[model samples]
Target: MTIKPHALKKGDQIALVSPASRPHSAEALARAEAVVEKMGFKPIIAKHALSINGYLAGTDEERAQDIMDAFSSDSISGIFCLEGGFGSIKTLSHLDFSQIKKHPKIIMGSHENTCLLTAISNQASMVVFHGPNICSVDRVESIAEIKSTLASSTILPPVTPSLGSFPAGFHHTSYPGNAQGTLIGGNLNAIASLMGTKYSAHFNNKIIFFCERDERNDIIERWFTSFYLAGHLKRIAGIAFGEFPDCGPKDSLSMKSYQDILTERMIEHKIPSTFNMPIGDSSLSRVMPIGIKAKLDATNGKLEFTESALD
Candidate 1:
């Protein structure tokens, strides 16, 4: 069964945990805290949120423990990852999925936290947020919509022209068809890393939305081919491509663009897909709920949620 967390309130206390990388500095954390407070929610820093172990926030066990503690805590209404770099996968085995399943709460982040989000979706069957991290809290221009999404249990509609500012690809559609399924997916690199693991997403009969950044077209092609070889692309109800900023071909001699590579793959499998979705490593991204049922209307360029992500 799908487990939805309770809707957040103005006074809800959110725990700031670093499941992936540590904050850039103490100043960044303070700014993040200030932004959360300005949003009218209490920010509770996780015990080891700032511990740095090379690039990671802390030891794998310590990072995992923060998540466990947050979910098990009576005071914390939600858990927000401080930032996403790498290391979340190391904590996967240490996490108690059962404990999180028993006490579902909003767990939100993007990029490297894609592993955690997918794991929670598959193991806990809980609706989780895929959006800005604590690092992006202060940088985003307007967070009113973000606050609204977190504070209520409401179905979200597809991206409209006015909803976001995307590049030219946002208007592109691969196939003219409509399909509905529970939303599943996140960063392309992170999602691909989950292959051959227990935490890998079950894309069968689901609307998969994926994004990437700082990768070359060749690497993107390889990852897409991996999904196809794994039989994930053949079984999905539909596909939605998100922003792939700074992902151009490393070799100038390569003729195909990143969009061409993605489109050819989807067409090869005849999957109903849309490109240029606003969710990804961009400041203009909006919150997208994983594990929630949504309709992918490729014919009309829309992805409308059929249910609320929270109770």
Candidate 2:
């Protein structure tokens, strides 16, 4: 399916809706607004972006309406999820997929937002981004990725490598080979959530899967087991793992334990894998296009931009 690019213009209105976590203070919202305003686009908040109901931003019905309203509004050019925590999957069936498909717009977020972005793209055939959220990390690289993706006249190379230059806090590796395919993946838990669902992204020939999860101790083992058992990881040409945002220092297991779990899981499938490719809760994050074709070099441990993320 060909996706129409929803590129941003000078005065484009970007709707900020909370499809997930809603436990936000007034100060946090102000900061988010400031971040959006700094980018020069009008950031309009959904009425329930700050509503909190336990762990959810709002009721599934209310969140779904906010998303549907954004896409249905003629004045809005894009939908930017305010933040991701959980609950995106709960609101799925309530969304108007047909209306969103007819008036396609850029939908962007990461973490748990992965569920919504991937599901909508696969079901509606729209190009939703796996980039940073408004209240999420908006580093220089992340902003640049967003700008390039939403701009016209941008051309991506046929094959790209993950940018080299590891800082002291991070580690890297080399895959030594490359494969090309439509990029499809997000949070590991999110991908796992799509099992038995019609909205799951179809893994076809030569697809490169990028995934990450919150770094919870011993959880990686179960997550990867369920993910592979779901047949989501077996068909991909390559894999890239972003920072596990849920990893906490309180956990008894060391960082190496988490890495070992990932390695073991990939080795179980005998597929080449790359880890520590950056995207996470850190202030520094790179925004990767969700559905665009790109090269994953496990030898050099890099994911390069190959084509423009949008049509």
Candidate 3:
């Protein structure tokens, strides 16, 4: 399969579409617009970006139409999902993959956006980044990484683990081992929802998994169990668990408590895993290039790039 690489240039135009969840506040939407403006790209906001109906950005048809319009727009060099919620999957079937293939450009977002990213990667043979959404540019480091990546020529660098504390008791340490393979994963619930579907992200031997969790939701354990049952655990070579944003130990449980829950499962299956390397949804989260090759150094809790994602 021939992958069409979209070389992002400075001063290019990018459209922000809320294909999943709508912004919780007008301030959040403004922050996203501010991020795009600061990135040197002209930001185009779709009509549905501010339209909210429950958790979704809009109705399924509205969200899908915004996405299609963004891709079909000649002036837009890339499309960034504003934030992930729960409706991207509902609009996936309406996407015209062939049109996307013909007019290739970068489509990026993480969390629930994983389904769309993985499906496009497999079907369109394009490398889609699972990076921070516009709502997450509050952190200087993440914003810097995003800017550097989008402006860099021909390669994306690996992001080292950023150590920090969270109100919820976030923590990280090396696991004392290393593994390498193509990066494949996202929010556990997001990928889990694709199981048994034709759009499911395919994995094989030696795949380094990149997964993150959030505490505002209740489906963490459920999705983890689903991935295991769907045979992802058996096929993956190593795992990197990003900092679960707002998921530190609180109330009846601590961050360690939740980590313990997943650690026990990984150990039971003998799947090597690393925890709390910030990548998304954390103040210290790094920009990781999805659909690219990378190595996981569990001993030092570092993720190193094995090749140029732009290549």
- Note each model's CA RMSD in angstroms: 1.7, 3.0, 3.3
46, model 3: CA deviation in Å? 1.7
Best-to-worst ranking by lDDT: 1, 3, 2
> What tens-digit string does per-residue lDDT give for candidate 2 at 79-107?
88778888999999998888888988888
Top candidate by lDDT? 1
Candidate 3, residues 30-144: lDDT per residue as tens digits?
8898888777777889889989788888898999899889888899998888887778888889888888787778777887788888778777767777787788567766666
Report residue 223 deviation for candidate 3 (angstroms). 1.9
Candidate 1 residue-wise lDDT at 116: 95
Best by TM-score: 1
lDDT of 3 at 241: 79
Which pairs clash (backbone N, Cα, C closer than 3 Å) in model 1? Answer: none
Q: Model 2: residues >4 Å from true position, as ranges?
A: 138-141, 156-171, 174-176, 206-214, 246-256
Against the true structure, what is each candidate's TM-score?
0.95, 0.87, 0.87
lDDT of 1 by residue, 59-138 (tens): 99999999999999988999888899999999999999999999999998888999999999899989988887777665
lDDT of each: 0.85, 0.71, 0.73
Comparing candidate 2 with candidate 3, which one achieves the higher lDDT? 3
